[model samples]
Target chain A: MKSRVWLRWFVVTIGLAAVIHVAVVWLVPVVIMRVFMSRVAAQYGVNRVITQPLPTDLSRTVVKPSPDLLYGVCVFDVSAGPVRLSIMPPTTYWSLSLFDTNTDNFFTFNANDLKVSTADLMLGSAGDSGDAAARFPSARFVVTPHNKGVMLARLLVLDKTNMDEALAAQKSIQCNAIKRGS
Target chain B: MMTWVAKAIGVLVVAAAIAIGSAWAVLLHYPLQTDIANGSWRTSLAVGSTSADPYTRARVALTGLFALNPSEAIYFSANVDNAGRPLRTHCTYVIDGKPFVAQWWSITAYADDNFLIPNPANRFSFNMGNVPTGTDGRYRIVASSAEQTGNWLPTGTGGRGLILTLRLYNASPEILRQLSSIELPSIKLAGSCP
Candidate 1:
């Protein structure tokens, strides 16, 4: 009888351990992203473009930051309404990437992907039911999975010679919340 | 009855410990399941993608948050050199390569904590535009703690572990499809270490 009791406890312990392991694994990314988004939104507010300076040894906001690129970050929340993003990409290599709360990069586009000089994009969710396409016919509608996320713009500053141009392009990045309807 | 209660409490504590410990170990030490190895460098196509498994997502969140999807950029990292030796800060290395088949490319060095190493020069990376190439159209970058003549990427002081990340932005489809077969920069150790 004592042996059977011990076996039962062992099985219970193993099962509980497995459950905890899976929970920790799944929750790690969600928690990390939440902290990052909260920190950025608190400092810069939502739906506003903040151009970061060139990364050096003192730049510890993120890990493995590239010194050759200028970063523009927009922490967005679309629970209230959709957000509009407009940017004039520089002639050099540039890209805009969207990451969800789970740290998944859902949508991204580079300068070569754009046919025009500027890009106008609308970020919305499925619940944002409207003819956004018809309302803003010129803008491309990008549906995000999460209500809150981040939009990162990376502009390559090849050398000191083109730093001025890159800074100008970074300043042109804009993210604003759009009111419901016209 | 008192003994049984004590035994139950012990079992719960052990289970929690085992679970948390194993989870952190796997996330921190294990390599990604989808990693593609080319020499000493490794990259994962699922990095920063929706399709990444749970472990991969967690690892990226901890080490490289806000990473771009492989479609937009491919990040290849090397903790070892060409001879399969761990990169050390005190040692000198020579990185030789040609231009990558991408719109832009760069190589940046990081310390073991995944941050830029502190150096007086304030230099942390070498890109195609900044690095001068040779007559044969190939560029060489000397990574060392001490100053070198041309194209010097400081490794900082102290003997910390070094990590090199090569970013290929807008890489050609062919290169992405054949990532394992593509040619990457060769990191060869130079001179003896102290």
Candidate 2:
């Protein structure tokens, strides 16, 4: 009788341990994957890559972001004005590229046709007022209106390296048109 | 006496089986494989190579109010054929059943490298919103640079790499589950551009 009870107890303990091990090794990864996927979905701001239709409307003035998000983007109305880009300190490999709304072509960035020196950019706009000043080097360029609308403004944060600063800088990138007859 | 012990063991075994099975199903089901059309795209979609790992691929039936996230959908390069000529483009697709209240769906063609083809017509995509459909509600999307109309997705003028993305929105759950049953579009190169 005693041996039988000990054997039953051993089997129960072994089975429970196996269950816990599986939970830790298998279930935990699954849960983490789900959480990661959700975060990616929110971060990329793309609805469904393979299976869904894209929304036509681009009217939202700002990218509404989640707390853990690494990037925020919005496809603005081209008539809105020259896109103002802002970069906060200490974060690396961040950029905002503009595309032809209909054709998705590279337009320009940072007040230049290409990505110019961030240092030279600072030199050009030195002592300008935060408001009404050229935000990027390309600010000097003309905003010629096109018949088709621009599609999206992509703000990429490499490695989510400085996620906190990225989130804040995301808010700082602003856009407005050149004043009428200015 | 033995029967009671056997019944108890059976119950425990069945319970364990259920738990393990459910866990396995959840972990293994989605995203089976992704085939990179290899050199089919002409330009590079990314900064580096054509193939990428940890990529996201989906199987969707573009029927009702479905949408794509433009950010994640990277473009591939458009390549020309081996003979130094533009590729002839011909293609067709089928939608097995009817969709109710389909606002619009589209198949945008991209070069293997993920850039829009340079074309005079400024056409790059085909959509149900503008293309014609059969009376039975079936649809075919054609990709070519040859300037065909009615569901012609403009391929880059050169015939090389091609990637077709079909977008569907607001699809019913029934269609989602039956994705395996849906047929993919077919392509046959008829001739090349001069």
Candidate 3:
């Protein structure tokens, strides 16, 4: 009986020691990772303060996007339909471009080329439009069977001024290719 | 009877001491670092403007001895240290076999302070996608500022630095419970910028 009791005690002691060993190894890393992520969040938050008023026309800035940080840009190609490009505001910087399927070249940034700036579409002949995409009806492109696999690249530009806002805007960007119905 | 009891007590004391000693030893081996220079891995760079976050302050404070959790995904935001301080990048990562989620993963490069490097080719990312694995199915990525044909990510120029991210998604939760056993990539300075 006494021997059995001693054996049980031995097992308990070993188990306790093992628990402590695993905790030290595992808990340290969890703490460290948290520290790293929290630091990033804080850093991004501070960056928003220094850059208050963003440039209305970013074309002239040394850094077009100020602090150009492109997180993820995926090119989605669709066939036999019109692709819809959507944008959500509260972003430090945001833009999208359309690419031709045949040549694989960028067609336009915000519905305009260098020769014609689409920024004026909403204002009519006055060139004082509010939304570039909504103003120009010709901005939307239709792909036929021959032009299958037309592509669009969504650019998620985040600068120091609006890191959190940009990160949040990620969920808002979506794309849908329109098809003909009966 | 009294002698037997005394002997049992003595054994218990020894056992308790051993347990405490073991715990102390394991804790001592924990991934703890004081500063970045004393072997703390450089996860990312910062330039132009420093972070105002307390966590960033702590990271910058501990410039050495940052032990990474190999099984989990780690993220970093970097920037050039100085106006034209060139930052070099290099890493060698390994993946395990089995039905593990992250049997394959990637390491991408961003310019100083976490922006995509402006390359005319639009080839800013470098990862396992470029490196063809052997029959064994293991992968590796080499990040650098220099222009190389295979798995090379440019740092824009020698003047500014770049940020590197190592992502091990869908990792085995079980293996991650034991960080030391899992193998991780080794990031170091390959050379200085021109």
Candidate 4:
């Protein structure tokens, strides 16, 4: 009887452990992204760009940041449909990346990826390409499995003298709801 | 009745211990980190991968969002010198780097808290685009509190206890396939300390 009881305990213990580990690993990304998006949304209304200067101290809400890089963020929501993003990179090293709530960068494009001054792309949840995709054949398409996430544009601010210039350039980038003319 | 209750409690105890303990070690510090290029750099191959285990997935999701898979980018971090001593701000470091095959690469300095250390120079990183090369096509970056000519990266005030993050973006096929065999940068302590 005691041997049977021990076997049962061992099996239960192993099973419970596996469940917890898998659950935490799978859910941590979604949970963290939700908090980040909510905070960004609260600070700057949804679908709008929030351009932030280089971090000066550890007091800022951003975690583990590189202070020399100017950042522009948008908490994207494609539940309504596809979102249209327009970027004009200043004459410097720059990259724009799209992250799903799961924390995977499904799509990343750099200045080298585009030759034009004005770059446009369609960001959407996994599904149809939508009419915006047809309109912007030249524009890239980024599809995320998750409905809501973040789009971050990072520009390398070589020095302090260019802060104002970086800000001006950041102001011109746009992440807006797609209004396709069908 | 008492005997059964005792066994049930034991099972719960063991389960919680195993679940939380493994998660803490794996997701927190990346205990499974791989050392490459004669142990000069360290990275986790599983990070940002679709096939990453649960622990690695959670760790990357928590620490770095929007990280590329290894095929697109690979990140290596080092906190100690080649001599196996903890990097300190009081001492200067010479980062002699040979360009790993990549479309572009960069090395950025972060404080103990993982934020950019603020300094008067406003310099934070050196990359392939801006870093000046040497006579032999290699680059030597001096990370010091005092400014130096050529390629200089400020450690800021109290920047001694810093972490260096090396990022290779759009890495070449040889690097992505055989990272361990290739030679990377080496970090050495420079000058005598007070």
Candidate 5:
């Protein structure tokens, strides 16, 4: 009887361990993204573009930051409504990337993808109403998997000579929440 | 009855510990399931993609959050040298390569903690626009703790493991399609280490 009881306990332990392992693995990314989004929202607020200077050893805002690129970040939440992003593409190599709450890079476009100098984009939740599309006909509507996510603009700074130009280009990037029915 | 209850509680504790430990070990130490190894470097097309597996998503979130999709940029990282040796901060390395088929490219060295190594020169990376190439259109970057004459990438004074990340922005279609077969920089140890 004791041996049978011990075997049963062992089986239960293994089953519980498997359950915990899967749960932890699945939750790790979601938890990390949540914490990161919260921090970004706290420091920079949601639906606002903030240009960060070139990353150095001193910059710990993000891990593994590239020193050769200037970063512009926007933490966005579309629960209230859709958010609009406007970017002035720099002449040099530049790209804009959008990441969802799960840290997935769902959408991205570079300067080559743009026909004009400026890119106007509207980010809405996947289940959101399509009324905003007709309202903002000029803006390209992008449906995000999650209501909360991030938009990152990267401008390559070739050298010290072009730092000012990169800064100016990043400064012109704007992200704001679209009011309902307006 | 009391002894049985105590044993059951112990078993539960051990099970929970094993679960957490194994999960963290896989996430932190083990390589991703879809990693493509080329020379000493490794990359994954699933990085920052919605179709990534659970472990890949967790690893990317921990190490490289907000990374662009492979179409926009491809990230290759090497923690070892050409001879299959761990890259140490105390050792000097020479990275030699030809121009990449991309709009822009750069190589940056970071410590094991995934942060830029603090150095006196404040130099962190060398990009295509900054690195001077040879007459043959090849570039050689000397990564060392002590500053070298030309194309010196500081490795900082900390005696830790070194990680080198190569970023290819706007890579050509051919390069993206054949990522594993592409030619990458060769990292050679410069001299004998102490």
Candidate 6:
């Protein structure tokens, strides 16, 4: 009888471990993403891009930020409708990527992603009104997996002396809400 | 009975232990790591993509939130040398890099805290845009706490261990499709690593 009881306890431990693994694994990303999104929204507001100050040395809250690169961020919300993004491609290296609420990068556009010097994109969810996406050429339409997330834009600063110029170029990039058929 | 109460507490303690222990283990070891250049350098196969596994997403969220997938940019990090030893702050290293099919590339060093190491030199990274190549178009970067002449990346005077991050932006699809077959840089131990 004692042996049977030990066997049951062992099985119970293994089963509970598996359950815990799945729960934490699935929940951490969601919770972290939500907290991050809330912070960005509070700091920059929604549907806008805020170019952060260059990461100071020995000061980084984000993971392993590249010191040579200048990063700008926008928290996107597509619940009301699609959002429009316009960027003047820098002469130097630059890229823009969109991440869904689940922290998955659904769409990414880089300096190479641009055949033109300037890129205009309309991003929305599949559930959003089709007319909002129709304003832009179909080729420039990107659909997110969810209505809320982040858009991260990175511009490489080649010379430390020319950082101000790079920030000016980064400021030229525009983001705004999309109004359908207006 | 007193025995029954003790058994119930035991079960709860066991469950809590399992939950926290497994979470920590997954956080430390669950991300997919692909070795490059004889395991001297490595990158994640799951970063910045929709298809990343749950553990990878969790780990990335904790460590690196904005990591681009291999296609946009492939980031390789190294803490070991060509002979497979931990890189110490006191030790100097020779990074022999190959010309890649990328439009732009760079190598930056970060301390153990994942922040740029504060050095009096104010030199944190070496990129194609800034560093000058040898007459033959080949380049070499020195990783040391002491000052070196060309392509010097200071690991800081504090002499803490550091990680080197190599970014290849706009890499050709062929390279990403077959990372193992291609040639990456080598970080070999220079002098003594005591």
Listed in order, the DockQ scores are 0.76, 0.04, 0.04, 0.42, 0.75, 0.62
Q: What is the TM-score of chain A alone in each candidate?
A: 0.92, 0.37, 0.36, 0.86, 0.91, 0.88
The sequence of per-residue lDDT tens digits that candidate 4 reaches over residues B1-194 is: 99879977877788878887777767754456443444557776766666666566676665556566676678887777888777766578899978777766888877666667777887778877678888899999988878888788888865357778888777888887777766777889897755
Best by lDDT: 1
Candidate 3 off by > 4 Å: A1-182, B1-73, B76-104, B127-130, B188-194
Stretches off by above 4 angstroms in model 5 are A1-4, A126-129, B1-5
CA lDDT, every prediction? 0.89, 0.36, 0.36, 0.74, 0.88, 0.78
Find the candidate with the highest TM-score and give its number: 5
Better of 2 and 3 by TM-score: 2
Every model: Cα RMSD to truth:
1.9, 19.2, 19.5, 4.0, 1.7, 2.7
TM-scores, all models, native as reference: 0.94, 0.32, 0.31, 0.79, 0.95, 0.89
lDDT of 2 by residue, A49-160 (tens): 2111111112122111111223433333323233333344223323343332222233323222334343111111212323224344343333323422222222333223
Candidate order by TM-score, decreasing, is 5, 1, 6, 4, 2, 3
After TM-score superposition, what is the CA distance of residue B120 in candidate 6 from its true location, in Å? 1.7
Candidate 2 TM-score over all chains jointly: 0.32
| Root-mean-square deviation of candidate 1 | 1.9
* Model 2 alpha-carbon miss at residue B73, Å: 11
- Candidate 4, fnat value? 0.50
Q: Give lDDT tens digits, candidate 5, residues A1-182.
A: 98998899999999999998888878888898888778878887899888878999888867899999999999999989999988788788887789987888999977777877788888887554477777988777899888888899999998998888889889989899998678
Q: Model 2 segments beyond 4 Å from truth? A: A1-72, A75-182, B1-103, B188-194
Chain A only: give the TM-score of model 3. Answer: 0.36
CA lDDT, candidate 2, residue A9: 59
Per-residue lDDT of B1-194 in model 1, one digit per residue for the tens?
99989988888899989999998889766676798999878999989998989988988887788899898889999989999899998899999988988889999999988899999899999998899999998999999999999999999999989999999988999989988888999999998866
> Which has the higher DockQ value, candidate number 3 or candidate number 4?
4
Deviation of model 4 at B132, angstroms: 4.9
What interface RMSD do all candidates show, one decimal each?
Answer: 1.4, 17.3, 18.2, 3.1, 1.4, 1.9
How much native contact recovery, as a fraction, does model 2 achieve?
A: 0.00
lDDT score, candidate 5, position B176: 86
